[model samples]
Target: MKDTFKHKGLRQQLVNILITKGIRDEKVLNAIGKVPRHLFMDSSFLDHAYQDKAFPIAADQTISQPFTVAFQTELLQVNKTDKVLEIGTGSGYQTAVLCELGVHVYSIERQQELFRKTSNFLPKLGYRAKKLIFGDGYKGLKDEAPFDGIIVTAGAPFVPKPLLSQLKIGGRLVIPVGDAVQVMTLFIRKGAKEFEQHEFGEFRFVPLLEDKN
Candidate 1:
């Protein structure tokens, strides 16, 4: 039997985890169900990949728990025409989920090795992210400015001000913010001169650092 399917039992457990943890968006739940989390990790760890737990993947990075991914995606509230910017494409799992939901995804991975691997894996999954960038995610993507939505997977000490400038009016940015401890924050650009902020709750994530690799 494929280790991937063997991991299916964990999926139900993850659903319960999300429900209990407050990730109640139905679209997020469906996306979690459709995307094959096991395919995003090394085969040796595939059995535990769907267990509502984070696991180290490559380049000293980790794929986030299924709940984190679903919670973040649900926070973004993506629409079909939304152009989404994602920071830290660790295992391409979250990126795949965004793509599955019909967003035009532009994902940035500071780790070169992860970038190469995900650039290759995304197409194979049949969900093509618009671009896979290798650069400092902290700087955000300028040329692709005015994104309709943005999701940052890593924890940041503060929200990147430049990223806020790049968001289109009416766009939403969902990011985890803090030092070692973090809070998932939602930023909404209400208009050219206004924005709204909401603090969700605590979350643990790999730090968002500046790097070319």
Candidate 2:
């Protein structure tokens, strides 16, 4: 599957960069290595795909850097059969990473343009996510509640309570929480009223807004 991308050198560079930045999970590294980052961006930005930097995609959204994507995925520690929910699907880049990790993914994106584009892009790229929702992700997907894992790509002022509610008892959610400055946080649902919070370092992401666009 990795060979089909035919960018072995680029993948290696990304892997090396990730390793240097402390992403140690081999599974996460492999998934990052396998997904084609270039396919998610415009041709003009193709050259920047391999770099460990976020670049603008359509609709004013930026594809997250390889480092941050791998960092969050590693924190989730997703298992092969787990059902995962992704809060934002900007370029379908993170969705591809989740798919590569072998999760049955349900991703939500509120941008109508990005949603429309990725609906076609993901299938054509042979990446598979179980479902994609074009609605306010702040509400989470109630019908698909209790996911094994949940990832929020955009930063939220407060961790959306409904998203926390949708997590399975033992599920883990990775999100960046803050208003102006954000810190990547992990919430592990231990019970209905109990959760463990683990804080990672800071990160900058687009503000998670409730846009039904």
Candidate 3:
């Protein structure tokens, strides 16, 4: 599996589509352009990798649609060296995007199979999160509390309290909340107990489950 000219071209086209969809963050678009999305998918689905659509990955998970990845990351406003807590490592595509932004990512994945596979796979692609924990995302990484940003890749019925508690003052948390259809939600920590909330339209994602398997 190589990131050839064709793959790079396809990624540029994907970035163009995201721009049309209103993903204006240059950093996000650049990361999307640089990362090889095709390599994240199963070989059989390689041809469809850059289509801006979500495709199934191992462990009953789906690599997020390219736009969704860009959209969430844009909301994060990541800065270099930011400590980011990523819930639901999933296909590790989102994790890779964050890493490309030069943030120190701590991603939590509940499914053991996906966790093990992604933990090994990302480093091979030269993308490494600070810590890829096989634990419940709902609990977050308490010892690493006060992260600069937190992103939940799955749709949660409600925002997890622990996640909010772990955000640093002035940090952002990007997540989708709902069951059938999710509303992209953002929480910005203003102070010790103050948060500013915003919602951005709707999206569909796999449910954010609790506990670890």
RMSD of each: 2.0, 2.0, 0.9
Order the candidate numbers by TM-score, best to worst.
Answer: 3, 2, 1
- Tell me which residue pairs clash in candidate 3: none
List per-prediction Cα lDDT, in the order shown: 0.87, 0.91, 0.95
Worst 10 residues of 3 by lDDT: 204-213
Strongest candidate by lDDT: 3
TM-score of each: 0.93, 0.96, 0.98
True-structure lDDT of candidate 2 = 0.91
TM-score of candidate 3 relative to the true fold: 0.98
Q: Higher lDDT: candidate 2 or 3?
A: 3
Q: Which candidate would rank higher by TM-score, 1 or 3?
A: 3
Q: What is the Å distance of residue 74 in model 1 from its true position?
A: 0.7
Decoy 2 TM-score against native: 0.96
Assess candidate 1 and give its TM-score to the true structure.
0.93
N/CA/C clash count, model 3:
0
What lDDT does model 3 reach? 0.95
